[model samples]
Target: MELYGQVLLIAMPIFLVAVLAEMWYGRWRGKDTYRTMDMISSMSSGVTNVTKDVLGLSISLLTYTWMVDHLAVFDIKATIWTYLIAFFVLDFQGYWVHRIAHQINFFWNKHAIHHSSEDFNLACALRQSISSFVNLFTFFLLPAAVLGVPAQVISIVAPLHLFAQFWYHTQHIDRMGFLEKILVTPSHHRVHHAINPEYLDRNHSQIFIFWDKLFGTFQEELRDVPPVYGITRPSNTWNPVKINFQHLWLLAKDAWRTQNTRDKFRIWFMPTGWRPADVADTYPVEKIDDLYGYVKYESKSSGALKVWSWIQFGITLLFLMYFFGHLGTIKVPGIFLYGGFIFLTVYAYTELMDHNPNALGWEILKNAFGSYLLFSTGDWFGLNHYFPQGLYLIAGYFVLSTLVTAWFVRKGITPDNFVTQATKSQSYSTLNTH
Candidate 1:
């Protein structure tokens, strides 16, 4: 956990910088693919996911170490062949796991968060899952286990593999001549994230492009079919935690509503968007079926609301970093307490972003809880030990945040959708690189 925290401390800044740079580049080129609240929602999702992973909030059905211990046929040294073979096996494992996640109703919830955003950008890449409490993909690494691969090799390679997927989740990058054919480029990933019928469930490979080619799921970004990104049934909310379990909740409701017991058991294993027959006819759900009629999920937001959202995002991020840096020093139940606080912070601000009228109340409660926790714990994760005025600074932030939120509520500040506003002002050509 400490090592992961350290990794976050180092990598978070770099990721933020990259997102900012991409934003600048897009603005300069006149494509501007990011919406402010959407970006905040995405980053908030990242925080929740990392906190879940850092706190070790997941269970594995079959341990990888056990697989390697019992299934090995030959002991292989860490040679070029070993590393090369490991990469291939991991890629293969990633492909199948990703395919399954998109194909099954029960598993889609674990991955739906990644497709929740309408706009595509580096910031949207941070939309990750936190409610996925099981690591069922470990069973896919059987080839590595059969080859006597060390758990250490798999551990080192796993993160590198995951991080490599981040860069390709952008609109700033155009097609690379030869690399497009060999790697999962930004163009390919845009298709993977699209809701367009031609692009749905296509290109499931992680690093190498051949997995999709071999498995028959690859689809090139065609000139005629410009991809419209996001899920068919929009989440329509900014809270990542809510978005994470939205699909599962729907499935659960369907399971209960169905008359047949067989339908209840079979609904989970059915195709990704499958619904029970009676429920489908009686309680029809809205679903997007055409790319030409795409309308993004959005809420009204004024300039002040956007600015306040950014401030809250910055505060939440700073406290998250503090929690990461001091993970070891904090004693029992402290880490869990920190995690709860982070979740509340994300939930409150996102509710505000979603334009919920009760958002002010949640924000007030969050600040009240924060103040009580600080007064009781005596510091912000032990910050008062080094900085004498740490408590005062945090107290000041809470006071200031509450005041700003209250001011917005009192002023009756109504907001307009950023994406709709931008689309009315700018035109994106289909022939353009983006």
Candidate 2:
């Protein structure tokens, strides 16, 4: 975990720089693809995901080392060729996992957050899953294990393979002539992210384009149809934690509500968006039908609220950097405490972004928890040694955050405001369709 923290210290900056550069380039090109709330929500989702990862909060059902020991047919040496083979095998595994996530009902809960964004941009690429606690699909790497690939090699190559997918999640680049045929470019990913009928569930490959072609899931971008991004059921709120489990919550409700025992048990495995017929008829969910005519999810916010949200995101990011830097020093329970604070901070501000009436209460809870940490640790997690006045700044920040949130609540800042033209023009689109 500490080693991964160090790796992220290097990687986090590069990612932020790339996202900011994309925003700047888009503005200069007269095609900015970022909204302040959406971008902040995306980055907040990233923080939660990395925090989950850095703390080693998951368990693998099957270990790769065990597979290598028992299933090996041939011992392969660690060479350039071994790494190449591992890369291909990993991409092959990713393709199947991606396809299954879009095709299965229960599995889709962990993946819905990635497709929740209404606009496709580099920042949106940061949106990842935190609800996945079990590594149930590690068996997908059986081919690598059977060939005697080392566990250490898989660990090293897995991160690189994941990072390679980030560059293609952009809109600034057009189709690369030959690379389009060989690699998953921006154009290919746009189709994958789109909700359009022609594009839905099309490109499931991560790094290589050939997996889709070989598996017969490839769909070329058509000249006449512009891609419409987001899920068929829009996540109208900005809270990443809520978005992660929305589908699971629905499934649980359906399981309890259904009278048919068979339907109750089969709903989870049936398919994405499936529901029991009785439940579907009794409790219908709204889904986007007229894809071109729907109003994209937007909440009314003034300039001041937007600026304050950015400030909150920036401060939380700094807190994350500190936590990552001192993971070894912070140790077990303390590290968990720090992580809890990070999660609460995200939940607090994002609720405010949604204009939720209970946001003030959440902000109060966040500040109370942060104050307890500060008073108990007596130095904001050993920061006084590094900087003499750091604790004072932290204490002041909690107070200011509470006051600001209270002020917004007192002023009656609600999502029901008439400022957003889309909110005024149309009601929010329906939820579950299938």
Candidate 3:
């Protein structure tokens, strides 16, 4: 648990640096909308995803613990060389596990949950299925079992690899020059997340870009090659379970419907979204295009507003740094507090930026639930003992409900204005005609 806390400490600073870097890049590119609502929506989705991953990681950790104990009969020697070997071996195993997760239908169903997001941000990195632990653990444990590396060593190193991955999820940084050719950069990863036909199933590196480059899966992101983000089909809400399982359900139905066993097998092994028979692909390719679409055209920024926004963004960055930095240290009433803080930070950022008003209700509900947990519950609700992690998780439903509400509010904002403007324009045209 202390190690987990330490990982969070290390991660928070890296996250802050990434945020600052992204902000600077956004400003430099003149695309600094930085709406609070969009941030809230993205963050809300991120918190829910992170909770699921934590649960999954916990289960995986337990499984690895058991494996380590059983394998102790072999009396594995722990040395610096063993640790180094374990690290590379684990990463190599991760490469295949991640690759298969994208390719195999059973795995892709769970993996697709991460790719469902329309927005690319740091929080999205945590969005993965709890079931993914099964895939991740099965592969890495093989090394420990065969090579006789201690379970303690595997547990510590595995998370370090994961912690190293969070910053690669952001859209903030461009290419890192020479580093882009070797290590996976935000630029390299953005290509992986891209839904562009040219980019699908490309850039499958976990710790090193060399895997993709050597294997011919690498596609260098060009300024002319605008990225289209999100999956071909978008999951509409922050519901972790649905996000995780929906693709699996679809694949199962497809496999069941196919008469030939070969076709059934093919459906599972083929690239995601492949069907034995063509049914018009259900996912909105255009919507994905819109989400990742980059305009070569530039927007002019007012010098004063740009500077003011930067200052405000800087303040928010500091707040997030402190919030995440102290998160593991503080014992809260429920798991929801952590989730609420994440949701609030994102929503507050987006709201302040005027990107999405739909995310506010979810943020309110999350805050309400967190407050309830903090003040209303005594030890009866396991406040002092276990901290009611499940109760806090209930805010996820409210967050989804609020997003739905925001959709309506957004629709109302536009059409009403358009209708009034149309009416006024018609009236003026009539008078002019007379």
The estimated TM-scores of all candidates read 0.94, 0.96, 0.62
Residues 1-434, model 3: lDDT tens digits: 43454465566556556655665776686554233323333444444444444323434443666665665446667778767766777767777777887877777876786776555666567565544544444645565666677777777777777777877876556678899877889888888887777788888887788988777789887676666656776654334445667777777777777666787777777876677663234322223344332221111222432343344345434434444444444445333455455445444433323323433554465456545554565322343444466444434534543554455345443322321211111221121110
Put the candidates in TM-score order, highest first: 2, 1, 3
RMSD of 1: 2.4
Q: Please give the range of 10 consecutive residues that has the lowest summed lDDT in model 3.
A: 425-434
Go through the candidates in order and give each one's C-alpha lDDT.
0.85, 0.89, 0.56
State each model's C-alpha RMSD to the native: 2.4, 3.5, 10.1
Pick the winner on lDDT between candidates 2 and 3.
Answer: 2
Model 1 gets an lDDT of: 0.85
Q: Write the per-residue lDDT of candidate 1 for residues 183-215, one digit (tens) a residue.
A: 999999988998878889999999999889988
lDDT of 2 by residue, 289-337 (tens): 9777787777677789999999999999999999999999999999999
Position 214, candidate 1: lDDT: 88
Q: Which stretches of candidate 2 lie over 4 Å from their true place?
A: 418-434
Clashes of each: 1, 3, 12
